[model samples]
Target: MSDPSTASIVSTPRAEQPTETVSPVGAPQGDRKEKPRGLLGDAWLDLRRKPLFWISALFILLFLLMAAFPQLFTSGDAVNGSLDRSLGKPSGDAWFGYDFQGRDVYARVIYGARASIVVSVLSVLGTLLVGGAMGVIAGYRGGWVDAVLSRVADVFFGLPFVLGAIVILTTFNGSGTSNSQWKIMGLVTVSLIVLSWPVVMRLMRSSVLSTKEADYIVAARALGAGTGRIVLKHLLPNCLAPLLVYGTIMVGSFIGAEATLSFLGVGLKSPVVSWGIMISESQSFIRVSPSLLFFPSLFLVLAVLSFVMLGEAVREALDPKLR
Candidate 1:
């Protein structure tokens, strides 16, 4: 008995018809506007506009490529050497010249990137896993837990980086030889992690403490979200900016630290072929072949500065106040 006009309007609720209704409120069907980007997306937009970021990014990419594929750049073997050519200066056949051991300096430098990058990168990653987790737990569940963890972090953090590494690495004195090179490297990496994670833990804990009291977080908790869910879903994203900046800078720091340790004869020993090892070996020959000291040190500085610059750019981009 319905009127014809009314009948047409009420035709049917077919499955296909509901698709249009599912669009966001006030939005037109099949004519969606772009959704607003989140923090990282906004960060990317800001980073793109900064020349420093691009420059540092290019250097990092080249370093990474060198690390991943050293063979692509040179057919020369890093370990192969001739004592007759020892301390030879840079020439057409040997760009970086020869080391005291008579090995091609250029080849060693290229191959050295793997160890230096691996140790520094892995140490920071492990720090993140250990420190970031502990921080989340402390910040989310305060009182006794926070007090204990904070105290522990303070104790380790009290030691200077170089001093602490020397103390911890002292256990492996004269141990990393040809057969056990990788093993010693692994232990060195672990030692670095133990020494360095406290800072990251403190940073994450403070960040979480600042963010947990926000209205949205309180609302999420009030709605019956569990601790893990709240920590992972809300607290982490909001609190990650400082940690990221510090981590980037720390990578460069660790690189220099590793080099220092090697220079002191306590890091990345023989057969490891790192920039640190190269520098360590070259220090003795500086009077005879300054190129030995120069090339590796140049690369080391470049690598460290690249990471530091990248961190600076990231900090400027991520912090709205800084921007």
Candidate 2:
């Protein structure tokens, strides 16, 4: 016979005893916090903590504002300059001084943002649309489709970027038609897009190949989802991170390429103020007015650097291996 207290304790129902708090998966609910879901959610959480990401993002926003509204940055005329003030030294009112035409270098630099930013952005978007589509189709339907697309991409990838651009632009620009700024912009945009998309296509193809085999994709297909549904609903989201990272880096490259083409006289010509045009036009007067070259070059370098930094930050954030 046991004591009454011992008997009562022993007689207590097993269900009434205190048990460790268990999660739905049967793991002890200790100090672990719930992690973020999805690629973008995790990347965003990490990006928010990175100072470099914020700084680069802020710079990009400022550049966009300058591109959209040049008037806000400067009231002076970008084109109209006094010959007398040509190569003028920096004054109280004009921080960047004057160009060879005596136009305000500061104003031109501010206005130049529009062309470079617009061209780069448009080219990247074009690349994404054309290249991304091809990549997805090839990746999702392997075999002969992949072979044909891969071969075509390889052909384009073999072309020399600058030389090819020069040939294309010269052919179009010398057709005896009126070379308006808009027309010139279109030609440059087309040339860049044609030459630049191969890289994106290859990246997307590789990413899709690795992602399509994922369990979720397989399950989605098993659940009677159509081809388009599985590709769009399941695969695209997984592949987008790499594309985004590549596109961000490619923006800076496109900007630099545009500048290179412009410097070679095949890019944006006069009347459309671009940093490239400014650099090319000022090379002759580099000895007399170094500021003309200095200011545009500085702005271009800063813009490219900012985009590259932002891309690297995003890549780091998105890579699970980094964590």
Candidate 3:
């Protein structure tokens, strides 16, 4: 038997309710507060958790390296193939072998990087500038501006994009004399942009239309944020993810189109070293020295495939629907 007071005290929820204890060794009250996660933190965590992102990043890095350092990897002179060593297969001296003209397959492939990068980068930039602006304007403005721009885009879209590029390059009169390498490249780039803008513009316009109606945009509006501020600061940033994804994909397409044009003799002519030009030059000797076509075509395929993979990876990373 226990004393009543003692019994009452012991039974009074002492065992049922655990006592809260403070330990100096435990996390401090101030230190225990949750820190807000940042965009970088989220992205980093996502990347670590996802395998596709890493694979995509790796390929993108590889292509960037190839594009940046052509001289380091390639052997022999890109332009001057030795006639004496013509039609040689892959040897220690020339890894990719010599072309029909005795040019190092390695050198031409490396130098071809310049043309691939040039056409893709410039064409994508032109697309972004022209299309992105139009999209923002149309999406934000709506009404007459959207109608007119949309109609114009449709008109351009009706034309065959590659054919249009060919026609323009043929007539545009480029920078280089006779061959017109620079001018033809510029012309083709511009023509592609003209046709390409509609796709980007439509994408951007759709993105903006959805983003502009979000709570943040509405809140900004209520807070007296100017149209310019809302657009540039709020809407534009949100639109970038999709645009970047598309832009990456577009690089491959643009490069392929440029190569096709060059192969057809409507693109960069002689004196300019383009993979497409190399392929075109080797068509006759394709049977005699397939190395001429194989190496350049190989590089082209790699470049295009790398970009495509990169774009898909980025899309998976950024798109909530995909995730």
Candidate 4:
């Protein structure tokens, strides 16, 4: 027995060595840190791990912010009607200078982003919905349905989109008011949807055709799954990856088409600021006021290039072969 004066010095159980904590060696790290499981999750993981993805994301976000807040970055009115200081060069006050109408180049470019993004996004959606539906039907049915749809797509693809848009706009030319801009945008969007869906349709049809022949599809069919049920439950889900990749690439193309049509005076009528309008305006003052040409063109190029780069990154990220 210890002496009465000597108190017991029992050591506390070493703080119980936290079971929740993880060591770098091989121990569990906070409940196994559940890994993300879906396509979006995988894409996010890939994006975070990739330098190109982050760089592309950053640039795109910067442009989007600029587009959203033109007033924050520039002076001189974007939509000022009167030509008070037309063709002004870059100054401390006016960052990107003024255009032929004294409207701020920076402001117009920023505003143009709205039009570009809207058109691109809508066109992509339209293409996916129309084309994807048609492709799925045609590929799965593969009878007269496929024949009729294929012929229809071929006919539209053969017709020149730019020329068709020009003709449409020429026939429906408005007084170039605010209302006219909306009408022009609608027409352009329709024209693009008509012509653009074929490529996506082709892609979707091919993808569905291949997917429908897979072992899983056969197994589903043998399990008494009807055509509608099989397609809804299985085929469509498998086709999502390719559709997404194609849709991403098509956004850039649609933007380019919109810009082209606007430049030709067949899209985005007056009162609607756009890159096409900027280029069209610059045609007159190309010799004297090159800023009109340079800044808008630069933004357009940047927009297109950024989307293209982003599409490439997305494709790589989604590609199982790459993984």
Candidate 5:
């Protein structure tokens, strides 16, 4: 019997104590909560602090610009028509001076970057495509498929890199084809790709083999994911870090290899305008004008050093073990 004034206060079911909105497993607790950057993002953050990274980056950018636009760097002609300034020392107007054939060494160095960049980039792309695919197949499929691929890779690995390059270049590019610039560069790029893909294949295969048994990968496989899904969506994203680092390093290696071949009289020949060719032509005149050997060699060394430094920086940033 409640009093009429109280109006029989029906207990309001205790207003069900407000429950914490059941958040998703990893949902942020508050508006100020921060998200983590993944491997690449974190690596980039780490790389930004390194002077070596920026120095290498600047040099690489300089070379890339030099390659993409030689005209912008200098107003003078790359090749001179006369030997009037032959073996001329580097000066104000003629920065790198004239070569034995009266060519502007400065302009030639600028233009030469194009051929090296083109060949290296093309060869790297080709190597990664061929090697990465084979590696993925070998690691994921395993068993007979893995065994067959491994044996093939071993065969290539057993072959000497320099010797293999010589044979391939000589066979593909005969004496008559020396003047054919594109043909020679193409053969060199192809030979490099053929010889280098095995390394990438082994690298990627090992990465995949270690990662395939991981929890996420196992979960993906346990679910309805197909082979293509697992590889394209899961495997590649995780495994490409090593390839990126290696590819950066390999660019320098290939550049050196191309120059070596040219110095040996089989790479980019006369009239093509590459740093290698410049070195090759200047060797005999080392005593006459050391500048001829000095300038091109300097540029080549800078380019190679830049790439190698960049690769090392990236490796340090990406590899937790380094930290």
Candidate 6:
């Protein structure tokens, strides 16, 4: 009915309206887009999805709870022992059985968690604080300071861990007063800190050196940020991820080191329940009551493995190269 030109114009399809793709829920696709998460956030998201992370985290939490309040785990006395109950099998009250000294092996094992966990945790913290600070300083301000710190680290690194711990602990042992539980723990912690910090220092130093040259750092410098501000605000944050990963793995290593020192008779003394000391005492009874050795060893292995697994999982999550 319309004119030919008018009809042609009407018949021509209008340019397709640029319709936004809608999601199943009828929201625009752009609105459904995910926001970006930074490094730590991304790592956390990844960590949450990993079964290994959850398992390790759960085990570590349980150990921490046990260490902090051992009473929750057991009420039996770890030190008090009855000669009559010596080498007894697992019974009604005693889940792991009596040890060579007739102490409730379960109680001793539970209580022992305190010393080992405390020592490893404290030593690692000390290492991180002292080593991390020194490393940051040296890495940020290279040249003579770095040289001196590097040399000092090398000197400490050259000293064998076990041998150094033995010598240091022997000196403390000679002091006689070091026989106390806290004193023994202190000596062991100090010895470990002295030996262990170099590795953390080197790691942190390397991380810092690499990070200080990043575009953000240069931008901060261009913006007239002071050295202290740049290091504290920017560089340190970047350095922490790798350092934390190392610290986690080192926690397990430190635990093993403490056990080794205790086994060598220079770690925790009598009256201070520890897995290593338990292992040392139970070695002779292995032929008679293998449970004594088996139970504590099992716990130690579990603790170490948990931390190691956690470290590995975190490393995988944080490292883009791994992804």
2 or 3, which is superior by TM-score? Answer: 2
Clashing pairs in 6: none
- Mark the 10 consecutive residues where model 2 has the least summed lDDT: 173-182
Best by TM-score: 6
What root-mean-square deviation over C-alphas does model 4 reach?
7.0
lDDT of each: 0.88, 0.91, 0.82, 0.81, 0.88, 0.91
Over 4 Å off, model 2: 1-36, 175-177
Stretches off by above 4 angstroms in model 5 are 1-31, 176-179
Write model 3 residue lDDT over 8-71, tens digit each, in one string: 8878976578877665766567646577765445555665776666676676676566678876
User: Which ranking of candidates, highest TM-score first?
Assistant: 6, 2, 5, 1, 3, 4
Candidates 2 and 4 compared: the better one by TM-score is 2
The TM-scores of all predictions, comma-separated, are: 0.88, 0.89, 0.86, 0.83, 0.89, 0.91
State residue 117's C-alpha deviation in candidate 5, in Å: 1.4
TM-score of 3: 0.86
Q: What is the C-alpha RMSD of each candidate to the true structure, in Å?
A: 7.0, 3.7, 3.6, 7.0, 5.5, 3.4
Which 10 successive residues of model 6 have the least lDDT summed?
Answer: 14-23
Which parts of model 6 are misplaced by more than 4 Å?
1-32, 175-178
Model 2 TM-score on a 0 to 1 scale: 0.89
Cα lDDT tens digits, model 2, 1-323, are 77999999989999887987657875766677887588888889999999999999999999999999999999999988899987899997788999878899999999999999999999999999899999999998999999999999999999999989989999888742467888888889999999988888998999999999999988988889999899888889879999899899989888899999999888898888999999999999989889889999999998998999999999999998995
What C-alpha lDDT, on a 0 to 100 scale, does residue 147 get in candidate 6? 99
Clashing pairs in 2: none
The segments of candidate 4 whose C-alpha lies over 4 angstroms from its true place after superposition are: 1-43, 67-76, 173-179
Report the number of backbone clashes for model 5. 0
Q: Could you tell me the TM-score of candidate 1?
A: 0.88
